[model samples]
Target chain A: MELEELKNLWTELSDELEKQKNLTDKIIMNMTQQRYTNKFEKITRYESVGAVICFLVAIGILWKFEELDTWYLKLCGGITLAFLLIMPVLVLRAIHQIKKLNILELNYRDTIVAFEKARNHLLMIQQFGIYLSFVLFFTTIPVASKLLSNKDFFIMEKEFSLYVLIGVVMVFLYFFARWGYRSYKKITNSAENILNELDNGV
Target chain B: MTKEQKFTELIKDNEGVIFKITTVYTNNESDQKDLYQDIVYQLWKSFDSFRNESKISTWMYRVALNTAISHLRSRKKQPGGSGIDKIVQRATENEDQEFEDRLKILYAQIQKLNVLEKGLMLLLLEGKKYQEIAEITGLTESNVGTRISRIKQKLKSRILKS
Candidate 1:
C-alpha cells in the first residue's frame, strides 16, 4: 500500500479509536488503581517471621541475663525487643495499605507496581535484620562475659557459639538483601521497557 | 483533583494512542485489546516518573513501543503456537470479507517481516519521517531511509501478487 493510503486507513481507525477512548480509559484507570496482593502478602509473611524470631531472641536474652542487674544490658534488650515487636506490625500495616480492596481486581500494571513496592519494603526489612544482628552480636559480648562467668564451661562455650552463629546469620541476611534489591531493579527495568514500546506505537 | 484522578484523565485523553498502536501491531481484535490494556497498565505504573520535558504523546509512544516489543519477545518463548500464528489465523478468517480481504493480506505479508523490518514498516506506514523512525528504532537516518524504500517496494510487490 502507498504511504498516503496507509495514512488514510489510520485516520479512519483513529476515529474508531476515539470512540472507545472513554471505555479504554476507564479500564486503564481501574487496572492502574488495583494493587498486587500476592507480593504484599509475601512481604507480610517475611516480616512477621522476622518479628517472631527477634521477639523470642529478646525473651531469651532477658531471662538469661536477669541475674546480671546491668542497666545497660536491660536497656539494650528492651529496645531491641521493642523494635522487633513493632517492625512486623508496621510492615503489616503498610502491606494492608497496598492491598487491593474487594471492590476491584488488580490490573497487570498495578500488579507490577505493587510488586516493586513490596520488593523495596522487603529489602528494607532485610536491612533491619542486619542492624539487629549487629546489636545482638556486639552486645552479647559484655553481657555474656558477665552473666556466663559463674556458669559451667559447657554453657559458656554454647553461649559463645550462639554469638558466632548470629554473626554468620547477619552476613547471610546482608547478601540476601543485596540480591533482593538487584532482582527488584531488574524486573522494574524490564517492565519500564515494555511500557516504552507500547507508547511508541510500534 | 487528586493525583490519581489527574492520572485517569490523562489516560482517558490519550487512549487512542494505545488503540492505534495495538491495531497496527496485532492482526486480531483480541490481541489488540490485550496489548492495549498492557500498554495502559504500564503507563499508569510509570506515571509518577513522567516529566514534562517531552510531549505526552511522545512519551506515550516510547513506552507503548517498548512494551509491545518486550511482549513480542516473551510471547516468542511459548510452546505449541506463536503470535504470528495467531495473527495469521485471524487474517485467514477474514478471507471471505470483501473490504477486509486486501487489509488481511497486507497484515499477513507484514507479519512475515523480521522484527526490525516490521518496526521500520510500521513506522513508515504511520507516516513517520526517516529521521524520526531512526531515532525511535535506533537505526541511522540514512539506514532508515534505505530500509523504508526497500520495505515499500517489497510490500508493494507482495500486495500486487495477492
Candidate 2:
C-alpha cells in the first residue's frame, strides 16, 4: 500500500510487460498501414460540407443578382448572402483550430489547455450559430424561394410553402442545436475537469 | 531506414508503454485496443515532424499520454468497473492467478485517480525522472514534485483505507 511498494509492483508489471508483448510487429505494421481518425473528424466533415453548400448558394444568389428588383428583397438577399458567406468561415476556422492542436507534438499541459480553448471556441460558435440561425432562417426562406423557385413569398397569394419551410427549419434547428449543445457541453466539462486537476492536483 | 520503418521499429520497442498507458486511460478491453491503435496512428501522423528536439521516450510519452487523455474525453469514464479484470485476464492469461489478481488491484486503484493524476502517476510508476516527467507533461519540475507528492499521499491513503 505504500508508495515504494506501488513502485515495486509497477516495476514487476513493467518487467512482465517487456517480456510479454501483446502487439506483435505484424499487428503493429498493420496498425501503421491503417488510417486512424481523430474524434473531431466527423465534425470536420460536416462543417466542410456545410461550408461548400453555403459557398455554392452564395454564388447562386450572386449569379441571379438581377432578381432582387425590390428594396426589401435585396435587403433579405443581402442578409442571407452575408450569413451564408460568413458562417462557414467561422465554423471551419474553429475546426481548423482543433486540427492544429497537434497532440503528438505538444506537451500534456499545452495540449489540454489548447484543446479546452478550441472546444470553447467551437462551442461558442455553435451556440452563436444556433441563435443567429433564426434570423438566417427568416431571411433565407424568402431569398431561396425567390431565386430558386421564382416565387415571391411576400407577394404570393398562397403562403403555405413559406410557412412550411419556416416550420421545417425551426424544427430541425431546435432539435439539432439542442443535441449539439448538450453533447459539446459534456465534452467540454470533461476537458475542463482534467485542466482543473492539472492546476490543482489530487 | 525509411520513416515508416523507423516509426514501426520505435513503436515495436516501446509497445509495452503504449499497452500500459492505454490500459490505464481506459477500463474496457475494446477501448484499450482502440486507444492503442489511436496512439500509434497519432504517433505516425506526427512522426514526420518529430525533428528529434527531445528524447524519443519523452516525445512518445507526450503523444501517447495526450492521445489517451483526449480519447477519454469523448467517452464517459467508468471508474470501479469490471473491465480492468478482463484486460488483466487476457494480459496475464499464461501467468499465475495471484499475479493477475495483484495487477488487477493495482489497476483498480489507478482507475480511481483523476485524469491529470493518472498521467502523473503513470509517469512516476514508469520510472521516469522528475525532469522527464516535467518535460513530457509541460509542468515545471517543482510543480510536478508538489503534485506527485500530493497524489502519492492520496493514493496511499486510498489503498490503506481500502
Candidate 3:
C-alpha cells in the first residue's frame, strides 16, 4: 500500500472514530477533575512504602545505637543508618520528578530533549540503587544480625560458618543488583534504540 | 462558557486524536486506555498554555506526541488508580469487522516504525505539512522533510515486501 492509500485508510478510521464519539462530558470531567493521576501511581506507591520502611528502619537503628557495641559493629551501624536515612530522598525525588510533570512547562519545548533528560534522571537513580544494593548487603548482614539475634559474627567463636554465610549473602547481592540493572535496562532500551535509530539515519 | 466547559468541548472535538495517539503508543489493551486518560489529563492541565484556536491542532499534536513518547509504560489497572477502563473500552469499541481488520494491519505497520519515525509518520499520515510537523515536533523543517521522505521510503519498501 502506498502512503496515500495508507492515509486513506487512516482517514477512514478517523471518520469512524469521529462517528463513534463516546468520551462523554462526565467521563472527561471524571478523568481531568484533579483525581485521575497518571500510570505511575503503583510504582510510586511501591517506592513510598519502600521509603517509609527505610525511614522507620533508620529510626530503629538510631534508637538501638547502644546495642551496636565494638568499633566495627558501630561502623556498620553508622553506614546502614546513613544509607537508610539518605535513600528515601533519592527515591522520592525520582518519583516526584515523574509524578509532578507539568505539561504546561513542556508546551512548545523540545520534547525529545526533555524525554532524554528524564530518562537519564531515572537511570541515574537506578544506577545508584544498584550500587546501594552492595552497600545494603554488607551493612545489612552485620546490623541485622545484631538487631535480630545479637549474633555478633565479628566476635563469634566460629569462622567457617561465617565464611559460608558471607558467600551466600554475596550471591544474593549479586542477583539483587542484577535485577535492578536489568529492570533499568528494560525500561530504557526502547528509548535508547529510538535515539540510536535517529542518529544512525536509518 | 466556563473554562472547564470550553476544555471539555475542545477535548470532545479532538478525542479522535487522543484515541489514535494512544493506540500508536501502546499495543496492550489496558495501557492504551491508561495512556488515553493520561493524555487527556495532560491536555486539560496544559489547556491554558495553548488557548490559541488558530493553532489548537498543532498544540494538541505537540502535547499528545510528547506525552506518548515520554510515557513510562507500567501496570496501572489497580483499583483507585483510574475508573475509566470501561470508558476507554466503550469509547474505542468498533463493531465493523472490515474496519477492525484494516486498523489492525495499519497498527501493525505503525508499530514497526521506530519511535521518532513513528511520530513523524503519524503526523504525515494525518496530513501535516513539513513546517507544521517541524513546529509540533521541534525538528527543523528540512529535518522533518528528510525524515518524512526517509520514513515514506521505508514504509514503501516494507509494504511492498509484505
Candidate 4:
C-alpha cells in the first residue's frame, strides 16, 4: 500500500477504535473491582480457617486441664477462646465489603492488572498468618502457666517441655510464612516487569 | 494540560493507530473489540513513560504490535482450532459487492505470515523506511531489505494467482 492509502486505512481504524474506547474503559473498571473482591474473599476464607484452628486448640488445652478451677484461669481461657472465635468472623465481614467487577477476556492489560492484584492479596494473607502465629506463640506461655499452676496439674519439667514444643512450632511457622511471602513477591515482581515492558511498547 | 485532557487529546489524535492495529490483528467483532481495548489500556498504563523520544505514533505502533504478537503466541497454545478460520468464513459469507474484495484478500494473506514477517509487512504497509523497520524489528538493515523484497515478490505472486 502507498503511504496515503496506509494513512487512510489507519484513519478508518482509528475512528473505530475511538468509538470503542468507552466500552473498553468500562470493562477494565469492572475487572479491577472483581479482582479486589476475589482477593478479599480468599483472604477472609484463609483467616476464618485460622480462627477455627485456634478455637480448637483453646478447647483442647482447656479439656486437658479440667482440674483448673481458679477464676483467673477461667477468665484467661475464656478471653483467649473468644478472641480465636471472633477474629475470623471479623475478617470474613471485611471480605464481604470487596466489590465484584467484570474483566474483559480479550484485554491483555486488564488481565495483567487483575493477576497482579490477586498476587498481592495472597502475599498479604500470608503475612497476616505469620503475624497471628507469633501473637499466639508469645501469649500461650503465660496462659498455659496459669492454668497449670491453678490445677497443680504438671511438674515444672513437663510444663517447660510443652513451652519448648510450642516455641519450635512457632519458629517453623515463621520460616514457612516468610518463604511463602518471598516466593509470591518474586512472582508478582516478574509479572509486573512484563506488564511494564508491554506498557513501554517494547 | 491536565492528565485527563492530555489523555483525551492523545486518544483523539491517535485513534487511527489503535484502529489499524486492531483491524489487521483481529478478524471478528469480538476479537476486534478485545484487541482495541487491550491496546488502549496498554497505552494508558504507559502514557507516563512516553518521554517524547520518538513520535507518539511510532511508540503506539510498537506497543500495539508487541501486544498483538504476544497475544497471538499465547492463542496458538490454546486447545481449540484457530480463530482465523471463523474470520475467513465470515469474509466469504459477506456478499457486499461494494466492499473492497481485494482488501479482504490482502488481509487473509497477511494473516498467514509468521509473527516476524507479519510485523515487517505491517510496517511496510504503513510506508515506514527500511531503517525505521530495522530499528523496530531488531533486524539488520540488509536483512530488512532482503525480507521486504522477498515479501513483496511473494505477495505479488499470491495476488496474481488470486
Candidate 5:
C-alpha cells in the first residue's frame, strides 16, 4: 500500500474505533483523575520515610555519644552524626530535582532535557549513597570495637584477632557496596538510555 | 462547570484521538487499552498546566505522543507476552471478519516501524502538517519533512514486498 492508501485505511480504522466507543466517559474521567503514582513517586515517599528513620537514629547516637569512654569512639560518633544529618538533605534534594521535571509543564524537548538532568542527578545521588555507605561501614568498625572493648567479656579476649575480623568486614563491605552500585547503575542506565533515544531520535 | 468537568468534556470530544494513538502504538487490544488509560491519565495529570498557549488538540497530541512513547519504553524494559490472541479469538468469535482483517493488516504494517517512526507515521496518518508534527514531536520542520519522506519510502518498500 502507498502512503495515501495507508492514510485512507487509517482514517477508516479511526472511524471504526469511533464507532466502538469501548469505554464510558465516566471511566476515562476516573482514570484521568486517578492520581496514578508511578515507581519514582513511590520510591521518593519511601526515601522520605527512610530519611526520618535516619534522623531519629542520628539523634539517638548523638544522645548516647557522651557515654562513650574513648576519644576515637566520640569522633566516630560525631562523624556519623554529621553524615546522618547531611545525607537526608542530599537525598531530599535529589528527590526534589526528580520531582521538578513535571513533564506536564514542559515542551517535548525541554521535558526530555529536564528528565535527563534529573536522572543524572539521581544517578549521582545513588553513587554518593553507595560511597557514603561504605565510609560509614568502615567508620563503624572502630566504634564497634571500642564499644565491645568496654564489655568485661570482650576485655578477657586478649588473643582475639581484631585484624582478621576487620579483614572479613572489609571484604563483606566491598561486595555489598559493589552489589549496590551495580543495581543503581542498572536502573539509571535504563532510564538514561531511554532519554538518549528520545534526544537523539534513535 | 469545574475544571474536571470541563476537562472531561474535552477528552470526550477528542476521544477518537486517544483510540487512534493507542491503537497505532500498541500491537494487542490489552496493550492498546493500557496505553489508552495511560494517555488519559497523563492528560489529566498535566491538564492544569495546559495553558491556552496552543490549540487544545495540538496540546493533546503532544501529551498523548509523549505518554505513549514513554509507556512503550518502560514496557520494553520488562516485556511480557500478550494474551491478546486468546482474548481476540474469544471476543471477536463472531464479529465482522473483513473489518478485523483490514485492521490486523494495518496494525501489522504499523508495528514494523520503530518507536520514532511510529510516532511520525501516526501523526502523518492523522493528516497533520509538517509544522504541526514538528511542534508536537520537538523535531524541526525540515527534519520532520526529511524523516517523513524517508519513512514513507521505507513503508512503501515494505508494503510492496509484503
Candidate 6:
C-alpha cells in the first residue's frame, strides 16, 4: 500500500483509540498526576541531596576539628575535610553536566552523544568515590591508633596482626574497585552499542 | 489557569500523539501503556520551556519522539521494569477485527524499520511537513526527503513481496 493508504489506516487506528470509552478523563488525569519520575531525574535528585548532606557534614567536621587532640587525629581530620570539600564540587559539576543535557533541544544523534558522555563522566565519579572510600578507611587506622596511644589504650608497635589487617583491607579495596569498574563497563558498553546502532542506521 | 492545569489540558487534547508514538515504538500492550505514561511524564518535565515557540502539536511531537526513543533504548537494558501489565486491554477490547488486521499489517511494516526510520515514518504518518520533520528529527530537509522517499519505496516493495 502507498503512504496515503497507510495514512488512512493510521487515522483509523487513532480514531479507534480516541473513541474507546476507557480513555476517560479520569485515566488521563491519573496519567498526568502520576509522578512518573524517570531514572535520570531520580539520580539527579539523589546527587543533589547527597551533595548538600556532604557539604553540611564537611562543615560540621571542620567546625569541630580543633577538639581532636592527637597529631594523627589532626592529620586525618585535615585529610578528611579536604576530601569532603573536594567531593561536593565534583558532584555539583556532574549534576551541572547532567542538567545541561537538554535532550529536548538537541537532535536525536547529539542527544545520544551527550548522554553517553554524561554516563562516562558519572562512571569516573563513581570510581573516584570508591578510591576515596578506600583512602578514608586506611587513614582511619592511624587516627584511631593515635587516639589509643593518647589514652594509653595501646602502644604503637609494628605487629603481624597489623600486617594482616592491612592485607584484608587491601584485598577488600581491590575487589570493590574491580566490581565497580565491571558495573560501570556493563552500562557504558550497553550505551555504546545503542549509539553504534544509531550511527550504522536501520 | 495555572501552568500545570494548562499542561494537563494540553495533554488531554494531544493524548493521541502519545498513543500513536507509543504504539509505533512498542509491540506489547503493557509496554505501550508504560511508554504512554512516560511520554506524558517527560512532556510535563519539559513543559515550562514550551513557550509557544512551536505549535502545540509540534512541541508534543518533539517531546514524544525523544521520550519514546530513549525509553526504548533503556528498556533494552532492563526489560519488564514496568510492573503493571493489564491496563491497556480495555482500549483494544473493541477494535473491529478488520481494523485490527490492517493495524497488524501496518505495525508489522513499521517493526521492520530501524529506530530512526520508525520516527520519521511516524512523523510522516502524522502528516508533518518535511521542514517540521527535519526540525523535530534534526535531519536536514533534503535528508528527510530522501530517506522518506526511500522509506516509501521500501514499504511498497514489502507490500509487493507480501
Taking all chains together, each candidate's TM-score versus the true structure is 0.45, 0.77, 0.84, 0.43, 0.70, 0.63
Colliding pairs, model 6: none
Number of the top-ranking candidate, with TM-score as the measure? 3
Give the lDDT of residue A180 in candidate 3.
76
Whichever of 2 and 5 has more DockQ, that candidate is 2
Of 3 and 6, the candidate ranking higher by TM-score: 3
**A42-68 in candidate 1: lDDT tens per residue?**
656886787688678667666775765
Cα deviation of B53, candidate 2, in Å: 6.9
lDDT of 3 by residue, A33-131 (tens): 654455567778887898899999899988898999888889999988888877778877876776566544553235655565576687778688778
lDDT of 4 at B30: 60
List the global CA lDDT of all models: 0.57, 0.80, 0.75, 0.56, 0.70, 0.71
Could you give candidate 5's per-residue lDDT for residues A11-56 as a string of tens digits?
A: 8766755665556668877787674555566678998898899898
Report the C-alpha displacement of residue B101, candidate 3, in angstroms. 2.4
Model 4 collision count? 6
RMSD for each model, in Å, please? 12.1, 4.3, 4.8, 13.4, 5.5, 6.4
lDDT per residue as tens, model 2, A1-202? 5678778888887787777666666777788678555557767888889899999989989999789778888999999888889988998898888777778767888877787778788888887888788888888767877888888878877668756876887999899888878977886787778777666743
For residues B27-144, write the lDDT of model 6, one tens digit per residue: 5666676788887777777888888877777778887877776553343322322222321335435636666556666776776776677888999988889999888877788878
Of the two candidates 1 and 6, the one with more favorable lDDT, higher being better, is: 6
DockQ of each: 0.14, 0.53, 0.46, 0.06, 0.38, 0.35
**For model 6, what share of native contacts is present?**
0.37
Worst 10 residues of 3 chain A by lDDT: A101-110
Query: Which ranges in model 3 have alpha carbons more than 4 Å from their true place?
Result: A107-109, A157-172, A186-190, A193-202, B51-54, B75-95, B160-162
Error of 4 at A129 (Å): 33
Model 4 residue runs over 4 Å out of place are A1-202, B72-96
Rank order (by lDDT, best first):
2, 3, 6, 5, 1, 4
